[model samples]
Target: MTDDQRPGEFELIERYFAPLAGPGGLDLRDDAGLLRPGRGYEVVVTADALVAGVHFFPDDPPAAIGWKALAVNLSDLAAKGAKPDGFVLTIALPRDWTEAWLKDFAAGLGTLAGQAGCPLIGGDTVSTAGPLTLSVTAFGTVPAGRMVRRAGARPGDVVLVSGTIGDGALGLAVHGPDRPGWVAALDDEQRRFLADRYLHPQPRIALAEALQRHASAAMDVSDGLVGDLAKLLKASGIGAEIDLDSVPLSAPARAALMADPALAELAWTGGDDYEILCTASERDYSALIAAAAERGVPLAPIGRIVPEADAVRYSGKGGGQGFARGSFSHF
Candidate 1:
């Protein structure tokens, strides 16, 4: 390419990068992004990345990708009951990414940060020889001795989940291949609901903070409920009994699972739900819900922690109850 035809990185950033970087907050021309936390605040840091085919689909929208990339990291902080301070983003762009695509991506990222009261601090951008990837590191702070940990669950603590579950997994089912049973019965709108869930999962940051204020144990439901809850129980050195009928599936999910009994296991094993599963004393449950409601968030009671004889158990319909064994696992 001729000298004039070559795209300068700075010029490319200004033309496409600055706008999406969020409204007039950061100076894209600076050597580094700026981050300023208020006095007396201690920062907590967390990071996560999504590979195009691995974490998300190739057809996923730029805005949703940007929103979710930040949301997932924020969810971690929320589980710790932290206040978001800011975030940094690193993007591995495909060689052919148009200026418009970058602009949209930046805009999407900016919008999420602005609304969440977290600023985009700084990050790197590089050309990727392979599929697109986004990495975001989020920062936050909380009062001393206020952060919740997974290891705090006491036996007899009531287990709770924020919002419904299984929607995202159902969303994947609708978009991907039809499994032997449940996926086939979904109508177009039902399929769309599931697909949207898979594409867009809201982070439970605010809810996490609320839970930390009152919960003995707290975790985000990134993996299936049974799986993630089991992790929390293991961390707390406790065991739990989750009523299968009380697993809190959405209407679609309930209907779908009802259609294929085998898929009930899939619902428990599927990952990427992004809700919050927590445990609190029965005395604290109302308070937890009240705090969440003050922030306009929803919380629900689903199960309870028991002695550690078995890791987890499930009691389904028709007087059925048994061990869960495990949930969505990489191995």
Candidate 2:
């Protein structure tokens, strides 16, 4: 299009986003998406938003921001053992919009959408005087009555987590303004590793099928292990005893903790891990581990569910530790 014929919002949708639209999206020319789940399948819907100085750094790359906005929501669906189907995106842009930034952001979002087998359906865009905000509502499908939930954990069930914890939290410590002094001990490679974890979290979508087959209760850990686990336990009407020593840690996080043991609390409570925290019967735990391993995803048994209601106990070599704050809070 010529400069004088520059596309407006609707035209922009056709030019840039329409290509990513699925059948339900009606080529982005409809008032709303038309989702039709197959027989014996239920739709799983999850939404997450990233804000300029809140969910992510304001100066972070637009592409990374786009990936994270979609990935966080996908993580939720993964926990529920759902298969990606489609999504809707709503963006609030600053008054001064740049085509280059939009192009990069859409590319990042579209790439992941395609990879996950989820297509863009419909959404809205608007101008905002405040910070840029991107919201995504992703849709998925799960077999009827098989969706995993946070309320199915029972006493004697094993608590497990996929991949390492604390990496995302540590990554934030490396780049956040209030970073601990100990972050200085990290070398360039270590810093980059942690920062990348913070910038790009890998959603464990590959293990959803295994989760449905084995996990009794499941949730994606976004608000720190300690707090998110507590939420899960409460929902299940039970309690847990977590071994602080067994909470998985990435190599970079381990090195940082070795530099300053005090960093352990931050690692546990700092949030943004995006790993799956699940509970399964001891009889099924081994099979679940094997299944996840077959897919090249590591599932670590960290603790066990207890009969005590609504209580989370922590124990390790240093004795018991408590957190003044359990998880990340927007308020």
Candidate 3:
């Protein structure tokens, strides 16, 4: 359809998005969103962009696509020990866009948005000749002086990761067109478990408060654990030695690994796991673990910060591992 027949941007937004708007969004009629700063609290903001066939499969479910666009940013907020507040969204649709697609996407997004207590604030809409693109800039609040950062870790701090790693990575493998022969070892439930993990990221929002009380330095393992941990350590001007055997794994990932032990590399190095990777002082480590366990999130200790500056050593079959391009880089 030509531009003349297409619905106005405002009409589309009001129909599919305005209902998701948070406070100060002015029902999408205002020039800007206003989020008054809470007394004694600070705001944390993070953004992530996803493009068709880049961040996600072009044929992926529209709802999953919508959920992921925001989840990734929320993961960032979680790493910073922030709680959901509100967010702005930007979407660039290709020529073949439709109202039905937007409807389903909004439903998918609203499902998680409501669950997470994050709301849409305001944003821009436009047409693009390129692939479908979506971006979310999310805002969250943490008590003043309590927001977590990636530079506070010191020597002797223990490295801990929440939940299992590699599930999302294995999920990606199952979703790929060239499905690995090891896929045969996984049952239908295992396949679904891995695939769903890839489609929906479980941001450790519940563990945010615990992290604030215990974590010295933290960041979500959006890339690979090893690479992201390296980044965190570099920020703190420290190093670490991790036991690869201790890296957490889900049932499906373990099954796949058992079928093909070599998949350990992909499981350990492939990105998409949104779990929180953090460092905590050994003294506060128990509190952190207890907090995570209370929230029903598994906390695994994989390594410890060392005095050697900027060194990352791992012991396991994955020893001497090196990423060709160093984790998932859109660039």
Q: Whose TM-score is greatest here?
A: 3
| Least well predicted 10-residue stretch by lDDT in candidate 3 | 322-331
Counting clashing residue pairs in each candidate, in order, gives: 3, 0, 0
The superposed Cα distance between candidate 2 and the true structure at residue 146, in angstroms, equals: 0.7
Better of 1 and 2 by TM-score: 2
Give one digit per residue, the lDDT tens place, for model 1 in 1-331.
Answer: 1135435677766665565555546876677876565666567778998898888876667877877898888888888788887788888877677666666676667677777778776677777889998999998887766778888998888888877787887778776644445666877777777777777777776685677579888878887777788788778887887776776777777778777766676676687788888888988988998999898877777778888633665565621533243442211
- The per-model lDDT (C-alpha) reads 0.75, 0.87, 0.87
Q: Could you give candidate 3's per-residue lDDT for residues 1-331 as a string of tens digits?
A: 2367667788888788887874434667788887777899999989999999899987788999989988999899999999999899899988888877888888888788888999888888888999999999999999999989999999999999999998888999898788979999999999999999999998889999999999999999988886788788778988888888999899889999999998888777779999999999989998999999999988999999997777877787767655453432210
Better of 1 and 2 by lDDT: 2
Tens digit of per-residue lDDT, candidate 2, span 163-212? 99989989988877787888888889998999888888888999899999
lDDT of 1 at 173: 75
Off-target runs (Cα >4 Å) in candidate 1 are: 1-8, 16-24, 177-184, 318-331
* lDDT agreement of model 2 with the native: 0.87
lDDT of 1 at 249: 76
